[model samples]
Target: MKKTLLAVTSLSLLAACSSTQTVEQAQQFAPCTFPDSPTSEAPAWVCDVIPTDLAAGALGYAKKSAAGIGVMRKVAVNDARVQLAAQFQTDVSNMFKQAVESSVNTSTEQGAIENVVETFESVTKNVVSRSLTDSKLIVSQVSPAGGLYVLVGMDKQAYQANINEVVDAASQEQKLWHQFNGEKATEDLTNALNSLKAM
Candidate 1:
């Protein structure tokens, strides 16, 4: 009886240990990316880098491609889920360019651009474009600034990278703009850019 009881206990312990090990070893994965969108289970760096408010807006505008390479393309302007793309996009970009120029010590425009590239998302490759009938650049660069939510899907990595890039840029500057205390130095920096023209 004593032997049987010991055996049962040992079996239970071994089973629990085995399951824990399996779970730990399981290959965790994500999916393909579209334009301004997020992948499943956002990475730690994402939260650490981009502000939630800004990330939400940027992710809403991205889309992932079916063909691999983890490349994401933008959807049409008409099809944009987040309407503020016109305002927020430009604001984020301009801020990033300014910030990079200030900090990174460089000589050529190309070098500076490279620094900007490392710091922010590549807007050229990740844009969803449309020719507006109005003979003007609709949003120019920065989209409107506000709360934006990005719907996430499974098996998307490139899409997630796109979100990470933009969000990272926004929050990166947010930190730089702050001083010792809890002060918002660049308040509503993107607010005016995202607002409607006084017509």
Candidate 2:
């Protein structure tokens, strides 16, 4: 009976020791970090470090084609320029719409506002096309699939300059409709220009 009890006690002690060790092992492992920190499951290169300029400027992506690297780069740059131009056009259009709606209440003023908006849109389209020709290429890399990946960036300052010129021209045209409308119209345009500059 004594020998049997000693064996049973030894087994119980061994089981308890194992359970404690298992818990300790689990505790030793650190908590998982995500996004910024790479994990064992995620490769280091998968965690892309975005450039500050890329973050600030408009981003455009394009894949390489059979046409060649030069063609691919041009396509990528054009894609980025188009994206930037579209964004600029949308923002300016919305700002101008808001300004006109708030400032022009009468039918006579409304006609003038419509003319000003049309002129502004036409001028903006031209400027957007011209401005993006000088946009900077931020990144170009070969993908794992053996195709080139290109990224283009355009600074807000450049876009702002273009916007300012358009606004100035539109404001001058808006002034011809009514002498009283000049100060308020100019103020609204200035406000919109300031917002673009801030961006």
Candidate 3:
């Protein structure tokens, strides 16, 4: 009777531990909510206008002025594009780091993985530029102070598709590297790319 009781107690403890872990994981991806008053430089509506999740592409904000409304809009849109590019770079770098850490196991493989990640980072800028050609202007308003405030959004599907394309191209490059060197030269890269695709 004591053995059965102990066994049930152990199972109950395991169940509780697993449920707590699941809740923590869910909380990590929960949508962010802004306070009644946002203290950031960005407008209060900015969070509502743009997705906080990097997987959902990126948001760019810009405030610009010019002699005419047309010129001001043009310049502000351009500035927003630059901001989006920077955000895209950061997102790609962060995702690459996560993928590499999860996929590569050996310290000896770190150098090769870093090289591939760096290459992917450089290639990501070009991919983002091409992909964001169709990005939409989500918010455009005239600030009370007299300049245009612009916010642009790129859809997550579009961003993922572009990243997939880049990964495929990089995979081809890794294939070539493998041929010139050895299969080991590209194994970490291939694993890392696979991990990214899983994300």
lDDT of each model, Cα atoms only?
0.36, 0.57, 0.62
Candidate 1 lDDT score at position 98: 59
| lDDT preference between candidates 2 and 3, better one | 3
Q: Candidate 1: which stretches are off by over 4 Å?
A: 1-82, 106-199
Off by over 4 Å in 3: 1-43, 46-49, 52-66, 129-133, 174-188
- With a 3 Å backbone cut-off (N, CA, C), the pairs that clash in candidate 3 are none
**TM-score winner between candidates 1 and 3:** 3
Candidate 1 lDDT over residue span 94-148, tens digit each = 5555554454334334543454344344442234132111211122111122122
TM values, all candidates: 0.23, 0.53, 0.62
List model 2 lDDT by residue over 1-199, tens digit each: 9999999999999998787786658545344222322342322122233344432234444464778888867776677667667876777777766665655544435566676666667766766666644457776655545444445554656556666766655556644334335565656555554554454
Q: Which lDDT value does model 3 have at 159?
A: 70
TM-score of model 3 relative to the true fold?
0.62
Model 3: residue 54 alpha-carbon error in angstroms: 8.3
Candidate 1 yields a Cα-based lDDT of: 0.36
Who wins the TM-score comparison? 3
